[model samples]
Target: MAAKKASGSGSKAAKTTRAIAIDAPPLDAWSDLIGHDRLIAGLSAAIQQGRLGGSLLFVGPSGVGKTSAAVLLTQTLLCERSSPEQMAPCNTCPACVQVRAGTHPDFIQVSKPDDKTLIPLELLIGPVDARLQEGFCHDVHLRPMQAKRKVAILHDADFLNEEGANCLLKTLEEPPANALIILIGSSEQRQLPTIRSRCQVLRFQAPTGEHGRQLLRKQLQWSATEDDELQVDSVSDEALDAAIELSAGDMHVAIRLVRGGGDKIREALWNQLDAPVPDPVAIARLINGHLDSISKDVPKRRAALRDVFSIAVQHYRRQLRNDAKSGEYDPATHRRLDRTLRTFREIDRSANLGTLVDCYAADLTLATTGDRGAIG
Candidate 1:
């Protein structure tokens, strides 16, 4: 059968502009990984004992290094100088170097495009004209050119549509010899039962408290090393603490707060919410401007708005705490928090961002003014 070229130029999500860009450490730089010490140790032992399964599922919060850990494991499996018993990658070897560079022949990684809501079917199997002739499923079965094993990492497994998941079932059912398939998702509950049942599940927790602080510190150090203008000493402890609290243990959010002027945005949001009248129109404009500054892409804007909602939730929760300390209850504050949360969840499902923002702002106004009306 002759293969036909895929039609149209493929689409991609717009690149988000960050105040300071922080790249994940190279795959072979295992020491750079944070907050999964026990998981890593257990995996290393499993590798040494030859008990590691061919198909594995890593379920965890976003930005917690699940994908990074998968890449490191791939490096270990393919490293030229390391035996399985050693479970370590010699970063200097050809295999390790290629894996670190993302040029290794036996390593395959696929994730949902930022613009799209799900992992497209064509990514798993081949495009319509060449089913199984190309893409990840076909590539995973090919003979390894350098390493003894082929490793395929499917990221964003949470976004796999029914068709895509079904296409992957056969490969999961009978994987090629010496091949490893790893799926990374937010949670096992987000996965289809058939898909989850086929793989060994490893759960990961979001780093919190001291672990969260350490992660942020490490990121700052990395940023300092990469950009001569950035000095770790310049960032105040107060800023770090604020970022940690706002981020709630998600490193990606923490990074944005510390490096992306998110702290200032949060402060602005708080000030607006604290206004005597709490103008919904003004609040909506402030948030819309912040979202626009993040990206023109709707998905990115929606995500940023969700973060804004999180900040508002925190603000009201603090008010509630203060109310408790003063031996008084403010129903308005409690209602405002509830409305903010509802709007946050709606960000994903609502198509019209402007309307969502407008409604959200009005709801907050109503909640704050103690108006007896439908909120959000």
Candidate 2:
């Protein structure tokens, strides 16, 4: 493959950042990747020393390549010929090619079952002593077909709830020697503190606008106007004003209101002059304010956060399905959309009107639009 540059123009502030993809050499240059040198360097060193731990946690937000890094590390470890200074896999090599195609016999991807979201208790943790007397290997240590070390990659480590996390604790603490358990997660804090302390953690952050765009462009092949390759499109003045209020500088959240059913709320509010519509963000603010007041009024803040997240997710989903065009939506918006949906799904695993309306005004604001008068 050819080498490629990572992001857009890097600001001086970015030098201190831990964004992904930035350090990786693009396939174009395939050698001079700009940002990820620190992480790459560390992992390279670990693999060389053969001191890499059996259990590892790769933490950070989406799209940055915790998964990609795991894949690369797998490549490096499995490569037959290794120079003293170079631990990266030569992608053109047969081992690299097989790993890239995911046909490698030794690599096993352990994740939540397709039908179930969380890694099941029985699957991760073995049965109690009496029941498990037969000495069978745990699901993870079942051994690879041929490679020296069996690799088990767990993506979305954060999705494992308390029960799920606990189940893996025993295995994580005493991983099999033949096993390499690599976990891909968004953040250290997102997991239990006890779990956080056990394994070595690698943190990744959002790419700079430039590098982010490069990855987006190369992989997504998206076509749009951009500032230095950061393909940001300005919504109409009305949408901008609303998004600006709701999202602050988090463009990901702002874009959702534009591409998704966010326009529905806009369209609904444009009737007679006597009325007005609220933007989705505004609706969030209005409802959030009330929820805040109630939380302040009451002694605690239980369930409110979850409630807001669930309600907002429902709203975003409506927008997603309503406005989906050829399976496209702003990346940021889509992320927010997923967040809300997942939150609701979990809440529905247990856990809506006017005062209740204030409860959902922020979502309504996003959904409704255009009416200039007042909250409708």
TM-score of every model versus the real structure:
0.77, 0.54
What digit string (tens of lDDT, one per residue) describes model 2 on residues 41-133?
787677678778778999865545566677777776666565424765677766666666665655555454435656555444433532221
Stretches > 4 Å off in candidate 2:
1-34, 81-85, 92-94, 125-139, 142-144, 222-359, 362-376
In terms of lDDT, model 2 sits at 0.50
Q: Which model scores highest in lDDT? A: 1
Report how far residue 301 has shifted in candidate 1, in Å.
4.4
Name the runs in model 1 displaced over 4 angstroms.
Answer: 1-23, 27-31, 221-230, 271-279, 292-303, 316-352, 363-376
* Model 1, residue 375: C-alpha shift (Å): 18
Task: Give the Å error, residue 341, model 2.
Answer: 12
The lDDT for every candidate, in the order shown, is 0.74, 0.50
